[model samples]
Target: MEITFYQEVDSTNSEAKRLVDGGKAPGFAVVAKRQTAGRGRFDRVWQTPTGNLALTFAIPAPPSRPDLPTLALMTGLALHNVLQPLLGDRAQVKIKWPNDMLVNGHKVSGTLIERVGKVLYIGVGVNLVSRPENVPYETFSLAEVVNITVEELAEAVTAHWSATLAQWLETGFAPLCDDYNAHLYGRGESLRISLDRERAEWAEGTCTGVTPEGHICLADSEGHVTRYNAGDIDIIRTLQSV
Candidate 1:
């Protein structure tokens, strides 16, 4: 495992890609204190403060990316494992499907996974000391929720991720699905999901659990169960929002 730090960069994910092109092997972690052009899925800009947390690590590609859902879920579980302790036993530190990490409905962290050649790059950004303004949804900072420093939180997340990665590699998602579902945000709530694009259309359903393969299980009002792919989902809090 190799770690590199940059005071500032255009984006940690981009930096990781560049390093990979420069012959950096898998398991190389690239972290930056600030990003001039941070981004997330759907080409949205990520508003993370300097000195907060922008971590991107590379892993060798699996036989297939079919397990990406499990990969993302495990990453969220890793963050939850490190954060739930700080939030106490009763707090709702949960993962919003596909990307967002929510603590009591407020997003504190998020992850992005991309495949480049034979390696997969996992990019994560956590709000430590600052939060963005005018976001589509609510956001939170670790400083507001807990008193820990970004460095401490980063170390904890990394350790948890390492352990979770091993567990996933050994047992796959079957053993982790229950654990992932337990911390899933809006698990049993009525949600309006737009598949493919955020601005695409809306479909309302009751949130069901996840599949062993990582697709979200949703039960429609007609009592039919449907499983959707892990990524390319836009969740609306209320049906009226659709």
Candidate 2:
């Protein structure tokens, strides 16, 4: 668990990938104090203020070629565990499906996982001190509720990520489904899912717990449960005709 710190970088994930490309072994991390071009899932810009956390861990790809979605949820759960204690009754921390950490219904952190050859790059961005403003969705930062430095948060994240990865490798995601679902955001609530990136097609259902394979389950009015492998999910705050 060697962690290389950077004062500034284009992106920690990019730096981690570069290190692996240069023959660096797995089980190491790249953390940056600032990222000029940080990105979230689907290439969305992730604003990283100087005091926030931008980290990426390089790990060996699993031999069985595990499902990427399952791995992503696992990463989110790792982050959730780390933050839950720090937040400890301060506010509610829940994991939005796939990999987004929400606090009090606002996004606080997010995870991005990418595979490079035989290595996997798990990138995490947390709004430790300051969060981006004027974003499409609501956002929050740990600084608002707790006082913690970026270094401390980075250390905690890497440690938990390593432990969670080990458990996933030893057993599988099946055993952890309940744990993940327990902190799931919008559980048992109506959620709107956009089936395509274009947002032209949509599905609405009551949120059921995730399956062992890591797909989000949604139950329709007729009691039919459909598992979605990919989609953008959002909690429906107000009732509307769909």
Candidate 3:
């Protein structure tokens, strides 16, 4: 994989996309110490300090399950696997559905995968040193809790990603979902979900599991099942949400 490093950039996702568009081959990656206009899953701004990990890696192979958010889930699983050992066994490291990682319920990292014109860019941001304040949800940083460097974590994460990506491309989400669910944050709990984030039509259900196709499966109190396929939805944080 070819890598490009920058002291700062508007967005690694944007930079990587531009590079791939200009004929940069697959496996090209962009890394920045900081980003001026970094964005997350919903285009929410991501604030990264100099020591944080900001990267976007262009993938060579196409998605294994285009119907599922497989790339994001795989990225989260890889990160959890790598970060958990470093943080020690006592630290509670769990992965949120689609692509967010939490440390004891506070978000520490996020993943976003974008596909454009047969090319895929996996964008990831981790709060290795510091996290921005005034965010809507709780946040965490490794600097405050552990003795680790961004480079060290990056190397471990990328190695896991390479192997996981290969497995995903070879089989599909079925073979990966089991391990993925083992680290899931809100499994088998009462979940508060909003199919439409704009309004207050919140529904409560028992968080059963994720479908093979990537939709969140919820079995309501009435025994009816509900699956969310799209739109802004959040699992309302509860005392046991994580």
Best by lDDT: 2
Candidate 2 matches the true fold with a TM-score of 0.96
In model 3, which regions exceed 4 Å deviation?
61-65, 197-200, 231-242
Residue 22, model 2: lDDT of 85
What overall lDDT, based on C-alpha atoms, would model 3 receive against the true structure?
0.77
lDDT tens digits, residue span 1-242, model 2 = 89999989999999998888788898799999799999987798999979889999998887765565589889989999999999999899999887799998889998888887888898999999899897878899999999998889999988888899889888888888899999998889989888987767889899998998988889999989998988778777843211
Score every model by TM-score. Answer: 0.91, 0.96, 0.90
lDDT of 2 at 106: 87
Compared with the true structure, the alpha-carbon lDDT of candidate 1 equals: 0.78
**Which residue runs of candidate 2 sit more than 4 Å off their true CA positions?**
238-242
How do the candidates rank by TM-score, highest first?
2, 1, 3
Candidate 1 on 1-242: residue-level lDDT in tens? 56787888998899999988888778878888788898887788987678678989888887765676678878877888888897785456887885568876778887888888788899999888788878867778777657876566767777778888988988898898888888887678776666556556656678887888888878887889888774433355543320
Q: Say which prediction, candidate 1 or candidate 2, comes out ahead on lDDT.
A: 2
**Can you tell me which runs of candidate 1 are displaced by over 4 Å?**
89-91, 230-242
**Lowest summed lDDT over 10 consecutive residues: which window, candidate 3?**
233-242
